[model samples]
Target: MAFYLVELTKSVTVHPRYFHAKLGDHVIGRLLALTEGTTSGRYGYLIAVVQVERPLPPGRILPGTGHAVFPLRYKALVYRPFLGEVLDGVIASLTRHGVFVAVGPLSVFVSARNVPSDMEFDETEQCFTSVVQGSEDRLEVGTLVRLRIVGMRRDATEIAAVGTLRADYLGVLG
Candidate 1:
């Protein structure tokens, strides 16, 4: 439920020639150039710039640098994951403490404690395995898994999540 498409106002600095009647178009171009593919600390990934509001007022030039600063408003689509949200991702790597999964722009870790108690790490194979009756269920690198987000931390450059595979309908998908 963390996906959102909403309007946001941001400042863009451009050359004075872009300050005319078609200012909105130039602002939109510059805004997309700056924000697309960038991760906002709070908003998560800035996926797409959908629309730009019409003609913002021309901004004034700075004393030393004659750059014009304009406030541009626009709508965008962003993706973020919340606690308890179940997501599917491929196992990227494994360590003694946990395994890391890549879900789009986010990287999630499923700690050893969060894995099912029945499963144990296999050092030789570098995978997790569980003996269920007479059968063995295994999880290895490149395996598809369904996990629930237990915790999250965000910084200027990245987002990290702590996940659990111990719940019902959670763990290796196939």
Candidate 2:
């Protein structure tokens, strides 16, 4: 549906007496878990899943006696709404109007009529000019593009929205 709060900073002991938690952190009580892909960034880095809500106190850290309070479970992995969803993005930047696909960690918007119809828009070197010009290749600016999620809009603050790869296998992925 719609949920996002992600925040663990970094510190997860993992199964040391039911996953004893510590290290400048917290994990509020009761059920908390989320995990479902993407978090490495070749393009978008989107991976999320959290679970922390108890279990502490075991051997270790007793010299001065301090460390272990647990109560920090924020949880965030939001994106679950693209109106159609067919993500596979790259092309981090390109502008004269559009081309910004990063699909999953959020950055989707392939305007300029969703590029790829032989791509042409050189109002005299404004941008998007490559119907095979100069022969070095085309789709410049970190190209790796591919998109498909015709439309998606959200208001009431702004989670960000706007996507269109034109259609079929989307475009520019070579």
Candidate 3:
């Protein structure tokens, strides 16, 4: 799910104190500070700011402010999960409706309907349990599980995922 070497353009404001000979370094530092660990609306999570391309001339200083704004072009590493991709994560919580698994920064929900048909919710234990032949399987908080991304929904602030563990090899990982 990690995307490497993606080109991007960003605008950075340089304070007057940083206008000296090390201006390029200052600008690059500012760009990394602003973008590293930030999420892109189009891309998923930005892991790091790898490199800065050719630096364009700084734009005109703002009136009365004396700060220079520069358009910076750069490349970054990002992580974006795609639909139908299978991932392993720890179970964060269990609800009456489903299980919530935390996969890095992403939270995925595997609805009750998406769990294996044999599994049933155990209200007293707050977990899902199933018995196949003579063996017992259980899924609870902190359990490691493998799931397939079935759907995703994103808004301005967050991304949510719908997952399924009903398929073969897609369940509690033991």
lDDT per residue (tens digit) for residues 118-168 in model 1: 888988988888867775677788988999999998888677889999999
Clashes of each: 0, 14, 0
Model 1 segments more than 4 A misplaced: 15-26, 133-136, 155-157
**Model 3 global lDDT (CA atoms, 0 to 1):** 0.86
TM-score of 3: 0.85
For model 3, give the 10-residue run with minimal summed lDDT. 51-60
| Model 2, span 1-174: residue lDDT tens | 233545543333332244333422323322232234443222122344454433433324323434333333445454455467666667677776887766545667677877766677666555575676664334556667666766755444334557776677766666
lDDT score of residue 17 within candidate 1: 67
lDDT against the true structure, each candidate: 0.85, 0.52, 0.86
Q: TM-score per candidate, in order?
A: 0.85, 0.32, 0.85
Candidate 3 runs further than 4 Å off: 54-59
User: Cα RMSD to native, each candidate?
Assistant: 2.5, 11.9, 2.2
The lDDT ranking, best first, is 3, 1, 2
Error of 2 at 159 (Å): 21
